[model samples]
Target: MMTTPIPKTMHAWRKHRGNMEAVWEEIPVPSAPPTGFLVKLIASGVCRSDHNLLTNEKQPSWFQQQFTLGHEGCGTIIEVGDCVPSNCGFKIGDVIALLSVPGCGQDDCPECSRDLPQLCQTGYHSGIGQDGFYAPYATIDVRGAVKVPQGVTPSQAAVATDAVTTAYHAIHRRGEIKENETVFLFGLGGLGFNALQLIRAIGARVIVSDIKQENMDEAKKLGVPEQDLVPVGRSVRKFVEEKGLVGKIDTVADFAGTQETFEDAQYIVRQAGKMLCVGTLNHKNTVHMKIGIRKRLSIIFSYGGQTQDLAKALELIQQGVLNPQVEDGKLYDFPAVLKALEAGNIKGRIALLQG
Candidate 1:
């Protein structure tokens, strides 16, 4: 393949409105921010959340129309702006994770000061309010860029920004699973799989359930005991009985956020046990308040991963504590990316490398 010169216009997948198909078009390359840089995207992961936005099912007013779509991008710095430090760490060739979350530029903004702009109401998210890296070139504010460890490929680090790190936050921060506690996971998709590994590393007894046996088998290979993986429709009582957790388990992490999974989470944990809702269940799903009140359980709704969590997840991958083995359909390039995402055949995170 021959490398082409940097052009004023490049190819990108774009959508004009919520609930519309994304079309590839020749769009102008974004410019570097005064305190930011323009990065040439190497690869960007297609998450299920992106699918939702693409479909416009949960489209917010800010992302009204015509925006580039992608957040989990990794690449090298190409053009740095005036405020960016020449020695602020990144160089022309350094591989870095795109923060994707834009701050309000207000020093007093609570979310910005805490380095967690993901929660800022005034802050804009890439692929949402601003143009994301669905193109070869994208603009990113410098505050959230993190250097990737040596030897990690762009595909491997693509999920570092969201899927993997989101699990890191849900497990380590929200669930707060102790070394001795038993942790049950509902759904074994991208987030649940990483949660499974993180729980295992914490020395917590981990049990996972999913509709797909493939994910279960994958979990088993990650050192989760065969007995720990369960089928989706099976009764929670069976899992509790088989694990001998009559009253031993302390937590259940529900990543599916379906009504059935939420109810199962309630039944699986012991009295006063905690259940963290880490999944993006945006649809009409409901849990009986009576059951929750009766169990006296702690239900925590966890959203995106914290900024610091990404670094920890990257470290775990580097140290061999976590492994993300993605398949071909889950890692397609730009030409095929939209088709795969539109068909909804993606098993996990779908990645698109810049052409």
Candidate 2:
């Protein structure tokens, strides 16, 4: 059990000016969070999705000017509120993964009715639609916490909470790709690389693409063949004709959701092929209607994963099948990490550790 006394105040990265920025601020330590527990965060991920939330001109109408920023987190519970019963399975000092989305775990909510509480419309969306774990200490609903099995480090658990879970949702839950089918993966950066491994684990052949050469090189090191890596800037139609895989690519998973990425991938997917979209930025709904109608192409968009998806991701993590490469030199200071993230200077998915 944790023996350390809780601090009365902690440092946090708060969104100050309603723009693509957050500044470090001294905040009151949270306590007595209803149905949730106060946690001491070990680490959190600085994701492109976090960047997407920061860049959007329109902040959620209810967002506080000084709210904490972060969705991917791994923490140890320091104080469990009364609402979190012993049978709820969480307690003080237990390590847990934070669910990026909010959920009340109530039976009547639409997302809960469907057993998809990650899309919980009525509760905290930790770090995205609500106060997240950018702070050293934060509060989270007990239902939103996923137990980190023994042997997972805080950094790895932090990444797994969102990156691996989201990728699992994209590949296994949403894409439903079959064995031996050819899958085209766009954007092998942060989340794409994780999706690449999950797809391989399912026995599907993967064709990788990315806007960054560094990421392609990383995927190559992960066993993606040099020839199978398509440059996203190239015309998809031309690549299809040249590669002679026209109508053979079964699915196109777009982790890069720019207009260019979507438009280019639209042409690469086979007739009746599925295009699974998981990116949070640059979402252009410019579908090619006539062509899509004729081809019977299926397009699916997935947000964060459900609780079951987290379980599946954790299972993979336990089996040592899903460790995405972390960029060198972990950042302990939140402000410096935010600066690097805003510049898009960080090469891959990054972890932010407590100072």
Candidate 2 lDDT score at position 351: 78
All models, RMSD in angstroms: 3.1, 2.5
- Candidate 2 per-residue lDDT, tens place, 24-81, comes to 6788888958788888888888876666666674766655555678888889888888
Off by over 4 Å in 2: 17-21, 51-57, 231-234, 327-332
RMSD of 1: 3.1
lDDT of 1 by residue, 1-355 (tens): 3445667998787766633667778888877888888888887877766666666555456664688888887888787888887788876667888767646657899876776666776766787756887888887777657788876668778777888888898899878888998888887877888888899899988887887777777887788877777765677778678768766668888888877777777777788989888875545566768877897989887777755787788888888888765543222254466566557566666667654
| lDDT, each prediction | 0.75, 0.78
In model 1, state the lDDT of residue 227: 77
How far does residue 40 in candidate 1 sit from its true spot (Å)? 0.9
- Pairs that collide in candidate 2 are none
